[model samples]
Target: MNIYIIIPAHNEEDCIALMLESLVNQTLLPKKVVVVNDHSTDNTQLIIDGFSSKNNWLESISIQSSKEHIPGSKVINAFYKGFETLDKNYDIICKFDADIILPKNYLESLVALFNTDSKVGIAGGLAYINKGNQWIYETIASKNHVRGPFKAYRKECFQDIGGLKASIGWDSMDVMLAQYYGWVVKTDKLLKVKHLKPTGKTYHKSSKYLQGEALYKMRSGLPLTILSALKSAISKRSFLYFKNTVLGYIKSKNKNIEPLVTVEQGKFIRKLRWEGVRKKIKI
Candidate 1:
């Protein structure tokens, strides 16, 4: 089956070449590889151009220029370009971040999973962050991680979900949306990809922003988003730990409560806002 690989790159001149080289070395190479240059301010375009000229195996390599200043929009814009450029006959579409090195059998494993389960909409490999850095060979969620780094989908599954969301945590969004539509989604433990850098940001802050976005989405059709997150936290003991830390606040009785406005507070407030103040009081 023919598979198309889409690599959305922005200012990745330092890492793109290595990524391209890794793709060339794939045991099961893709039918076509398209790198979307999200109006990169660096020589990323030039590098793609140089490689595309020399590699005959790399079919239909194209560069798309984006005008969107926001990173999220740039990602969606690239998907637009890919959707327009890719052949409709391909069986599968694979998405990859520009900074990862895929195992040789990565593509093969994804295809195998799709063949095994016709209902499976999306499949992803495990992500290893900074094995070369301080954290080495840490099994980063052997399964169910559903990372955006390296994943594949049946072409029909992608079409059903209407393509990438273009927002942060787009992969997870796609996974949940697919599941909501009764499509099976999973991550393979054997397939692995190595991320090159150590993340400097905090997960809690990111989670807070995601919570706010979840609230925004809940206003539409999904009333169960916050409940799902809270359920996940509680089931995993994260909420219990958090509750232990904030136990005093629960007992403190304040008749007048102020609305939250900061980023983190906004997420909490937005979640509560969606649930309504009256519903919050009942809890």
Candidate 2:
């Protein structure tokens, strides 16, 4: 399978080199890798230049965007900058972060999963963050979830889902929409990708409510939103996170913000969410 990767990087000089190195060393190298330097004031561009100069498959592009570290729109916008330069000849398209170091076989293993199952729409490795001495699974999301940082989507499924949303919940939104369109989201626990930075570590204060806003935009409704908020708060062990999320939801509803999904899609999402909740309860 021909694989193409687009990495949206903003002020990621500290870790971008490592990420590039991992990709260049991958056993199954991507057909092309485009690193979008999103308004970085750091030496990110220098490092990208260093790699691109030596490697034919790798290249870099620059885009001007906000430096505020807003969760969704900023990165996805940068991704599009790079996406525009590529043709639609790729079998698998990946949106990777600038702070991750994948195993040499990460892309190869992902291809294996896709080859084994025609229904699989998305496939990725688990993320592990280094603690005191050992790397442990990142607990922010379910084990079943393939996090935003290392997403690889089948080309057909990517187009079917209408591509990614320029919102805080794009990752989750894509997965749900893929399932809605009859595609399976798969995660390989054995493919451990090293996450150099913990998720949300550098998010600006303005992003506090974006998660809640994302839930509202997804039309998750009040009850499901509450449950989702609670789960996040518990996982992060912060009451403020819960309060902010709920308040954000109410704020968006009151403001009558546009939703990410249509009425029928929202109904399907709500039913799917409820089914997951019920299954968890039964467990």
The candidate maximizing lDDT is: 2
Question: What is every candidate's alpha-carbon RMSD to the true fold?
Answer: 9.3, 0.9
The Cα local distance difference test for each model comes to 0.62, 0.94
The residue pairs found clashing in candidate 2 are none
Residues 147-259, model 2: lDDT tens digits: 99999999999999999999999999999999999999999989999999998998899899999999999999999999999998998899999999999999999999999
Over the stretch 186-255, how does candidate 1's per-residue lDDT look in tens digits? 7777766777643312133323334334334323223344454454467556865334323312222122
Clashes of 2: 0
Give each model a TM-score.
0.68, 0.98
**Model 1 vs. true fold: TM:** 0.68
